[model samples]
Target: MGSPVGLWVCLWHLSLLLLSWVGSAASGDCKGQRTVLRTFPGFVSDGPGNYSVNGNCEWLIEAPNSNYRVLLRFLFMDTECTYDYLFVYDGDSYSDRLLASLSGSSLPPTLEATSGKVPRTGHG
Candidate 1:
């Protein structure tokens, strides 16, 4: 039988391959669509193509009424570490509670607003 170390390495490489495939498959452009941000309980993406250098983008997700909270998920993400960032705010604007400040290629876990009418998401 193969050595335990060899088996572990093989499994590691396989996992990386699977992750790459998933990211590419789910990757796509926003297609200049505004409704993706406006619609409730929808998806958010930076698109398949690489984002512009030194560019800033933001989306404000809000519930249909004040009684609801916003939920967010990151299907795939590959931003420049340290240079680029994705910021999530718990309230309607940047002045509100900071929920998460995420970066890197790994997919982050789901995020939910504690108590806010609007949850703002920004990337730069």
Candidate 2:
């Protein structure tokens, strides 16, 4: 086994390497906004072109009727791993049950809410 002092040094270097990969882009026009979706079929994003740094956006998707539950399908995603995240909640707020915390280049699987409400949030 590796010595305890060597293990700690390795871990410290790993943390610094991870932090260096974040914040390479400027904040730009990436502002925080909340969108409420009451329609059946819709789309949402940070707008045209590539998403900038320091973005915090939220979308509250609700089923059109009482008999249905909200479903989310990710068309595409490629955020910085560990630093940026896409958070999915089963209910209306952040205090609800967290369905997934997604990041990196891979596309996440489809998520269905337990109730009629779901919140999708993205932060960079």
Candidate 3:
């Protein structure tokens, strides 16, 4: 039988390869040009009452100037209402950034959602 140390080394390498493949798949298709820069979420009061709920949020986009489109997905759900927000940032300077925001609402057990893309043109 092979040495225990040799088996462990082989397993470690295999695990690394699998992780790389999974990471690539999770980022979506963009000719290997997409990445999630940052993400933040918070809990808030469901409505006028004292009740509160949780939701999901994310921020992802293809690297700027990659000549590829950007897709942004966001979902928020709570007892009072559900909300979804999406935005795009494109400009020569930070001051010229663009923002597109969207939101949805519905009761519990019924999900309200929205999604779209921010197309990219060679000219910013």
Candidate 4:
């Protein structure tokens, strides 16, 4: 026979272990990462190089033939960088669309990057 307090402690430990396992499994699902569209045809040039210090680049699609925006963030670098503008492709050529950009001078030690998509209209 075990004491009530001991049983309670065992139950708490089991719960913690289960929660940890679930968290690990959820993180494992994110093994394969997606690529961001750095360049396109019709759209203009967004910038020169990978401006993001640490974080990865991502493509944000809003609406087809409508306005779209790219969400970028910096990671653990102290370099001051600017997103400047965005460019969209039209199969053949690319046009430069000037817009506001996100910049970060410094970032924390642990920074994770993620991207999401939005459905757009008029796009083929």
RMSD of each: 13.0, 16.5, 17.1, 18.8
Clashes of each: 4, 0, 0, 17
Best by TM-score: 2
Give the alpha-carbon lDDT of every model: 0.51, 0.61, 0.25, 0.23
Could you give candidate 1's per-residue lDDT for residues 24-111 as a string of tens digits?
1222333322222434344455544677666555555655444455656665677788887778777676788888887777876667
Per-model TM against the reference = 0.64, 0.70, 0.25, 0.20
lDDT of prediction 2:
0.61
Candidate 2 Cα outliers beyond 4 Å, as residue runs? 1-30
Give the C-alpha lDDT of model 3: 0.25
Tens-digit lDDT track of model 2 for 9-67: 11000010121223211112446767677654555555545566787867777665434
The TM-score obtained by model 2 is: 0.70
Flag clash pairs in model 1.
28-47, 28-48, 29-47, 29-48
Return the candidate ranking by lDDT, descending: 2, 1, 3, 4
Candidate 4 has its poorest 10 consecutive residues by lDDT at: 8-17
**Candidate 3 backbone collisions, by pair:** none
lDDT over C-alpha atoms for residue 65 of model 2:
45
